[model samples]
Target: MPCGAQAQIIGYDQPDAEGGEGAAQAEPYKPSKRAGRGKGSRRLVVQPYIEVNQVVTAELSPGDDVLTYTEVAAGIDAGISGQRNAVSASVRYERRIGWSDRASDGDAISGIVRGYATVVPGVTIEAGGLATQVNVENGGSALAGGLFDGDSRTNVYSIYGGPSVATRAGDVNINANYRAGFTKVEHSDAFVATPGGAASDVFDKSVVQVADVEAGVAPYDVLPVGLAVAGSFYQEDISNLDQRVRDMQARAMVTVPVSRTVQAVGAIGYEDVEISSRDALRDADGDPVVGSNGRFVTDKSAPRQIAYDVDGLIWDVAVMWRPSRRTSLSAHVGRRYGTTSYGGTLAYAPNDRSQFSVSVYDNVAGFGGHLNRLIDELPDDFEAVRDPITGDLRGCVSSLEGSNCLAGALGSVRSATFRAPGIAASYSRRIGLMNAGIGAGYDRRKFIAAEGTILASANGVIDENYWLAAYISGALGRDAGWSANAYANWLSSSDPLVGDVSGYGVTAAYYRLLTQRLRATAAVGIDGATRDDPAINDIWTASALVGLRYNF
Candidate 1:
């Protein structure tokens, strides 16, 4: 029941990871098995835990073409994207609401709610919610170093809560839960004109709102009869914007008996998407000059299109088999044809000690969004603008004309009203107190223009794909209480074959138990990226923390 705190940093390069739209909206983290202890009465139990987190380093380097991170120069990368030096404090609260157990003389009808707010008491039925809102910075979200010349300050909020009921009939057990939530993005804007002939609002203040609902069920105790079902539905709408969107998904899985020592399980799922946008770039030759003092006036161009509202569906099927308590093998296949598409993964495990796996995904959208998301842009790859005589491409726009051709051409401002498909996979293993994982995947993304967009947004065909990432983690000693982790990532484009990305980082930490319910921890890390001009060099970030837990 890893409820609230979600880790979306893995998607630093994924623009539309938030909503199907190519906007920088808040994203929620998925649930993890390590969230709660393994053994506990199924009936009604509550475990409360807390931890304090902080950032030790925040750095930003953009050598033109803010979208440079999307490139992959190597075959595979082990690096994590979105490198920043940000420091902020956050609190996570969550709860698992489930039915009671019959094996422990429990009523089997009761449940419990967990979180930082209020804990629910034991009862026949239970209801609760999970939410995590954090204020983060980056050029994409308009906070730190702006990517593609766009930067701002904003926060992401994600929340979902519902109710559930579970009961047993004869020799069978059943459980179900339903939840819904929203991801919202807010921003501010103004106008600017450069000598490059570019004149228009440099930023815009708008809000993108998206809503979703998800439900899951599991049945147990019936002759290898473990079964689960889940579904999700979503919609995205922007204020003062002209894009419409909708999405839905449903899935199921079950296990089969192949003897006490052997078991087989499989799952399947499907999803649908729809989106549309028609906007303008400039009203007239100099319509960008409407405002002179930083104020902006809406300019219009004829209605155009990126990718139409496309209805799409994709599915996945997989099976797993275990020969012993320590060994297992599984295969999964997925296929999708939509505005965004993806699929595949196979995994093998020899024991609790080791495993291997691989997978892939891709997504192509309409256009890109600019800083503050107040404007939309083109796919210029505009790295520089040289002076005809001086040959100097130095500095910002020299004038309004330079602005329109070079400034407006920044492609720094962009946002698509829709999305495309994506895929990914990898293998991981645990070896004598140490865990190592390495794998590779590719992303084929399409950038479309946002509806009502007045900036750029080439209404043509353009695609971006890249890959590479590897990682390893392990503990050095029990008496020394030290652990080490490392990884590297690389990316690049296939068609144009120029823009590329590569970086790696490593960290080591030590831990000590201060008390039965409390622990103290410390760690430091170094980072290096080839993409960084002059090589950003070895950046050292450090942190320390004390956490407590309670099982009630």
Candidate 2:
């Protein structure tokens, strides 16, 4: 399951390959003739640029209006690669000036960074951050594609950091890791659709922390079978309704070698999982009190009521196989959280130019904790994909390790905690001078709320989301290039009033190097959203942009 550190430790027979004996013996090191010219050499690249563009947007439904604006932006892209550290980051700030009185002027900042560094012989530090904009539907869904021109847009910020220790004491290997994260959503309180409609409790902010430690010996090293012990702790504190979720577990594992390249593992453990929250304040008429920001007011004197509490024995069986260097698989079936749970990961790389991967996960967390975990799993070295007009980070990143996508996590922003089980797959390949990739996923969230509370209506509610995204880019020539991307999303909820929602968008861009320090770009895109409810109006818009950038 994706909820606890146990999921990360199961179905694996080898110690972490980063600083293990197997890794050190896999490759032979040769001394270089020139000093500071091999792996010790450092490489750095930094590019600062200024940009200017003109954007035009035309409304296609519910109204006939045209909006125009001039945008000025500045940004920097930097990367560093060495034996001890590897990092990459991009940041941009833009300000728009409208040409007409009815047009609204605004500014935005967006960026992404992920990296890791080796502080000592067997210790490493890793960190990442993300800042972006997203469109929020009045009902519940949040879309991260295309650009919107009104107050429906909001900013999201998240950051995480941790340290990992891996070392060997004689024959036993010790591994430990700890991570802390924080996430916040700005302007999320504008989710109230109508005066008398159902109130939407959007997420506010949260703090998440996770720690894991294990000691084990590989099979055939100390005995006929491998033996290990592990323990983990996970906690999340959500500001909305003062909610909290905590999980702690300890287990003993045994691994038996099935073949030269396969292993069977089994584990039994004790786990305690709890979820609790406070109720909202009430008025004289017993009606829930609403704050000025359109959210429920938390009663200071209210007690924290338990929504879920389960403690018992947990057991799991798993298999790990590595037939060759290009193929690997890990799968497990277990009983956790008082239910049957299962998850797995599969990765195949036929060659240096093509790769495929799939992952299935089961997790329980709030909006902030889920988002923080997604960021934490991103690759250490990657190129951030961004929307051309909005400058917001796209849901995916391109990397040599494997393409990481977040479409499954960005489906909803409701304040209630949920149990999420989802599956995602991605394929990427390099063809000549072109690169192409696609990702698709399905996610289901079952909300959990305390009975007899003001949020009782949300208890046991289920929401399902499906999404697809793809992109193709190549070089037009030595000094020119072109790219295109498209995405689609569909949402279904058990709530009748909320009904179903669907959204889609497509964008294409062309760029040419005009000079050694200057470049020109042009892009066009269209976006649309619709809901099954008749009272809500469908939205459609078309936009175009022309820009010039100078690198310094």
TM-score for every candidate vs. truth? 0.44, 0.92
Candidate 1 lDDT (Cα, 0 to 1):
0.30
Provide the global lDDT of candidate 2 against the true structure.
0.74
List candidate 1 stretches off by more than 4 Å: 1-181, 184-233, 238-242, 248-273, 278-306, 311-342, 355-414, 417-421, 435-440, 450-479, 491-501, 510-524, 532-552
Question: Candidate 1 residues 95-120, lDDT tens each?
Answer: 21112231111010111112211122
Instruction: Quantify all predictions' global Cα lDDT against the true fold.
Output: 0.30, 0.74
Candidate 2, residue 319: Cα displacement in angstroms equals: 0.8
By summed lDDT, the worst window of 10 consecutive residues in model 2 runs over 26-35
| Clash pairs detected, candidate 2 | none
Residue 151 lDDT (model 1): 29
* CA deviation > 4 Å runs, candidate 2: 1-43, 188-198
Span of ten consecutive residues with least summed lDDT in model 1: 68-77
Predicted model with the maximum TM-score: 2
